[model samples]
Target: MKKILLAVLVLLTFIGTSCDKVDDLLTFYINQEETITIESTFPIGVVTPLSPIPVKTNSSETFKNNKTRAELVKDVSLNKLTLTIADPADENFDFLRSIEIYLSNDKGEETRIAYLDEVPKGVKAIELKSTNAKLDKYIKGETYTVKTRAAIAKPITRDVAIKAAMRFKVTADPI
Candidate 1:
C-alpha cells in the first residue's frame, strides 16, 4: 500500500508540472484591435482613373509598446473593412461604380487588399468583413491607397464624398 501511494503522488506531481508548462507556452502577452479611417472626394466632371487616394500614414506611434515591424507583420491581422458613401443620396450617386484598396510602401510597390465591384444602389454603407486568417503579406511602413472607378450613366455636375474604415487586430509579445 505504501508503494502504490508513493507512485500515485509522483505521477500527480509530474502531471501538474507538465500542465504548468503548457500554460506558460500558451500564454499571450499582448492583444489589441485598431481602427483607421480614410476619406476622399470624387471630383465633379472628372473621371479619376485607378490612382492612389489619400490615406493615413503609418507612424512610429502606430506600433506602440516598442514593437518592431517584424513583430507586427507576424502578429497583425485585418479583421474588418467598411466603405461608406457620405453622399449616397446625391443625384450623381449612381455614377460611382466601384473602389479598390491597396497597400503601398514607400518603394511604390502595391498590393490590392480589398475590392468592391458592384456597390448596391442607394445604400450608404457597405461592410467587407472577412474570416481570412492573415493579411496578404502586409509589411511594416506600408500605407493604404484607394483607387476609385466611376461609370457615369449620365453626367455629374457635383462632387461626391467617400470614406473607408479599416479595423484590424494585433497580438504581440509584451515589452
Candidate 2:
C-alpha cells in the first residue's frame, strides 16, 4: 500500500511540472500603427457646336407705266462656329483655379461684338493651362463678324486635395 501511494504522488508531481513549463513558453502578439497618403487628378470640360441660323432677305420696289411690283428672297447657309479654350498646362495641377477668356477680330485686333463676361449658360468650363481660347458664335451682320477669335483673359487656379487608404495585419501565439 505504501508503494502504491508513492507511485501516485510521483505521477501528480510530473504533470504539475509539465504544465508550468508550457505556460512559460507561451506568448502574445499585437499591432499598432497608421499610414497616410495623397493622390491627385485634373478635371476636364466639354462643349458642343451650335446649329446654323438662317437670315431673311428684303426686296426693293420698282415702278413702270404707273404700275408697281416687288419681290423677296429667302437665303439660307450653315454657320460654322467653334468654341475653343486652351488647356492650362501650368505647374503640377496649377490649372485647378480659374480661366479668363477674350474675343478678337480677323485683323488681329480685339472685338467687342462677341464677348463673354463669364462661362455661358449652356457652355461648360474646362480646367487646363493654356494661352489662347477660340469659340464660334452666330453673326447677324452686327453682333459678331465672320473671323472672330477667343483668347485667355486672366489666369485662374484653385486648391485641390486627395487621400489614399491602407490596411495592416498581425498574427501571433496566445499566452
Candidate 3:
C-alpha cells in the first residue's frame, strides 16, 4: 500500500510540472493593424460610433509560426493597443478628448477591449488602457470587426487618418 501511494504522488508531481511547461511553450502574441479616418466635420463632445473595420484574422499563419492551431487556442486578451496619426505631419492628439475601441464578430456581440478617458496633448502617438477581456472566440474565428467610438475635445480643419496597432496575447494547448 505504501508503494502504491508513493507512485501516485510521483505521477501527480510530474503532471503538474509538465502542465506548467506546456503553458509556457504555447503562449504567444498576435498583432493586427487597422486605420480610422475622422472627417473634419466630426461632432465634438458627443460619443459617436465610427465605421466598423472588417478584419481577416490571418491568424492561421501566426498559429502555424507558434506551433499551435486555432483549435488549441485557449485564451486571448488585449495586451497593448496604440494609435498614431499617420498623415498630416504636424498633427497631434491634442484635438482628441476620449476614445473607446470594441471587438465583435459575425455574432453581432460587442465588447470593449481598450479605452482612454483623458488623452494627453502634444503627442503624435498614444496608448490606450487594455481591458484584459478574454477573447478566445473572437481570435479563433477567421474574421472579426473592430468598432471605435470617440468624442473629440476640439475641432479639426482637415480630415485625420489614424493608424491603430492592436497586440493580443494568445494562450494555447500543445498540439
Q: Give the TM-score of candidate 2.
A: 0.17
| Local error of candidate 2 at residue 169 (angstroms) | 20
lDDT comparing candidate 1 with the true structure: 0.50
Q: What is the C-alpha RMSD of each candidate to the true structure, in Å?
A: 8.2, 34.7, 3.7
lDDT of candidate 1 over 14-56, digit per residue (tens): 9999976754443323222222222244353444454456455
Q: What is the per-residue lDDT of model 2 for residues 26-128, given as tens digits with 9 covering 90 to 100?
A: 3111111111111122234322111212222111211111121121111112212123322322223222222222233344543322223243332223222
C-alpha lDDT of candidate 3 relative to the true structure: 0.92
Whole-model Cα lDDT of every candidate shown, in order: 0.50, 0.26, 0.92
lDDT of model 3, residue 13: 100
Query: What's the distance in Å from true for residue 72, model 2?
Result: 98
Candidate 1 residue 161 C-alpha distance from true site, Å: 1.1
Against the true structure, whose TM-score is highest? 3
Ranking by TM-score: 3, 1, 2
Q: Lowest lDDT 10-mer window, candidate 1?
A: 30-39
Better of 2 and 3 by TM-score: 3
Q: Model 1 residue 47 lDDT? A: 41
Candidate 3, residues 19-136: lDDT per residue as tens digits?
9887878888888899998889999999999889999998888888888889988899999999999988899999899999999999987889999999999999999999999988
Highest lDDT against the true fold, candidate: 3
